[model samples]
Target: MDIKELQAERTGIFRDVYSNKIPKRVPVNLSLTLEFTAGFGNLNMAEAQWNLSLLEDAADKLCQTFYSDSCPFGGSMRYPSYYQTLQSQSFIMGSNGFIQHPEVVGMDVEDYDYLIEKPFDCIVERIIPRQY
Candidate 1:
């Protein structure tokens, strides 16, 4: 069934369960990334990301055969950028793939007064969204 049909079928069951009624089958949400979730099953990263239909086929077989109801969702992994400049710090990965913390370079601001008075455009360009 499609998502709408599935939702219509399961919504009443979920509402009853929320009201302390026993559900025929418990729900599960496996919030795992495509890469990390490959560890659980016999799927490779490419298979999980590039070929989602195949991944779902494999999941369906595994779930039905093993009586498993686990569902996995893709997660994101963001990598930090590198900056090597006079007024900026940088991070580098070693040959063994070990990353070192960022090292501080020269002072970015010489005077607090000038920095505080600088216009918005004069500030460093925003690369990432601000998180709460």
Candidate 2:
């Protein structure tokens, strides 16, 4: 379904749930976003593929390498990105293998100069091999 249809369905389901009415169908919230991790630096198909694979592997194992500031039970359900730093305040791994820092990017950088001083840690140590 498209965005409009999805939005309408979500609104309807939310209203129904709030009103204690049984929804016609069960609502499943599959929220996903895109994350931009690593770049191949303008390489050919073969080289690009190699770099892309490496980035994907790095992103896949991000959660195991770093710990978020908040606990799982906390209100924050943030997921760490593949190219994120361990000290990042908030991060998420996008569906398209992109590492996103929505909170930081959306904030006023002038007010939050601390972010500039402490950028997220780029995990290059665990990246995939180009040969693969």
Candidate 3:
């Protein structure tokens, strides 16, 4: 089939699901992480994160390979170096080319009562600075 035909077919599958009707087969939507996409395309994850077009190409390749009905690309790509420069220690890029979330105890055991009392204040003053 041509590109238009392929798109129409994919759209029909989504329409079926949206209209609460079962189509001939279920549509497969693939959610790809940057690390997985980079590995699939044989590209460096750190470099791919900086180059969104390269990341998009990787995502396109994955969608075609997996015959995915829909795959949103570049949604999870983050600039770790930029964040790191900003002194944001929440997310770290490991040597394995994967983004790692380090565990941080934002709230102490005694701080629970304060957090419960002032949820917004706790998030803005306590959590935001620590995490981001």
Candidate 4:
């Protein structure tokens, strides 16, 4: 079948599931990680993260190879531009190019009163600044 026909059949499977109807078979939605894609495409994980199009291409190739019902490209990996724009300090890229989230205690143990009194402020002024 053509790409369009394949895509249509894939969509129909998902639509059936969402609409609470029995599909011809169970739709397999694959959750892919950047490491897997990078390895699959023989790409450096850092380069793949920076070059989102490369990741997209790899994901498409993977879906086609595996005959996946659906594979959400970049669903598990955020664009590097987003982190750059936000000046994010929370997420760290490892030497091997894997993204890591370090544990952070954003609030003091005694900060419960502040959280109760001003939840939005706690999130915006206190928690976010401390965490990110």
Candidate 5:
């Protein structure tokens, strides 16, 4: 089959599954993070994430390693630059290139009354700034 026929077949398989019908066969789908996928290509996760061109090798490796029905080549869900620019206190990049969310106490006990009185205002004005 050509590319369009293959795409249509894949779409039909998913559509059948969603519509409560058995597909032609089980769709061998998988979910993987860019950090994890980078390993298959022997890539530095951090460097590959920032230097987008490096992802071609990873995509090639992913196809070779898995028989998934489909996979997306896209940016990491947690972008390092956004976190760095925002001075994010909650989300930080780990040594492994994965984003980590640490426990944060954005508001003090004394601010409970303020939070109760103006929840949205308090969160937007004080808590988000502290955490992000």
Candidate 6:
């Protein structure tokens, strides 16, 4: 089938499923991760997200290799440069180019009162400052 036909069929599947109707067949939805796409294209995870052209080429190759009714290009999920620039301890990239989220406790038990008193302020000032 042509591209338009393929799109329509995919949309129909989602539409029917969301409408609480049984589709002609099960919807085979797929989700890709940044690391997976980077490895698939032999690209640096950090660079892939920063460079749109690289991501586009990799995405094209990725879709060609993997058959999925629906898949969002994974590298768009995170921009390592942004996180790197921010010096974020929450999300860090390793030598292998994979971003890892380390376990971090932004608030202590003693801070619970402050957190409860000002939820948004606690999150933005206390928690987020600690994270980024």
| Candidate 6 residue spans exceeding 4 A from truth | none
Candidate 4 residues lying further than 4 Å off, grouped into runs, are 1-5, 72-75
Candidate whose lDDT is highest: 5
What TM value does model 3 have?
0.79
Candidate 2, residues 68-99: lDDT per residue as tens digits?
A: 32111111133443234454534445554333
lDDT per residue as tens, model 4, 1-71? 99899789889988999999999888888777777887788888888877766777777787668755777
Over the stretch 21-126, how does candidate 5's per-residue lDDT look in tens digits? 9999998777777777677778887887677678787887777777677774434688788898999988888888777898888999877999999999999998
Worst 10-residue stretch by lDDT in candidate 5?
Answer: 67-76
Residue 52, candidate 3: alpha-carbon lDDT: 60
Cα TM-score per model: 0.35, 0.24, 0.79, 0.80, 0.84, 0.82
Q: What 10-residue stretch in candidate 2 is worst by lDDT? A: 123-132
Q: Which RMSD does model 3 reach against the true structure?
A: 2.5
Residue 54, model 2, lDDT: 45
Best-fitting candidate, scored by TM-score: 5
- Whole-model lDDT per candidate: 0.46, 0.40, 0.76, 0.76, 0.82, 0.80
Q: Which model is ahead, 5 or 6, in terms of lDDT?
A: 5
User: Which candidate order results from sorting by TM-score in descending order?
Assistant: 5, 6, 4, 3, 1, 2
- How well is each residue in 1-132 modelled by candidate 3, as lDDT tens digits? 998998899999989999999986898776767777888889987787667678767777777777577764435746777777877677788887666878876767776887999999887888778766
Instruction: Write the residue-wise lDDT of candidate 1 on 1-132 in tens digits.
Output: 996876665675667678998877775544555444444466665444444554565555444544323344444342222222222234443443323345544224553455466635234432111110
lDDT of 6 by residue, 1-132 (tens): 999998999999999999999998888777787667777788877676566577667677888878788875554466788898998999887776677889988998877998899999888888888898
The TM-score measured for candidate 5 stands at 0.84
Poorly placed runs, candidate 3 (over 4 Å): 72-77
Q: Candidate 3: worst 10 consecutive residues by lDDT?
A: 71-80
Stretches off by above 4 angstroms in model 2 are 29-132
RMSD of each: 8.3, 16.6, 2.5, 2.4, 2.1, 2.2
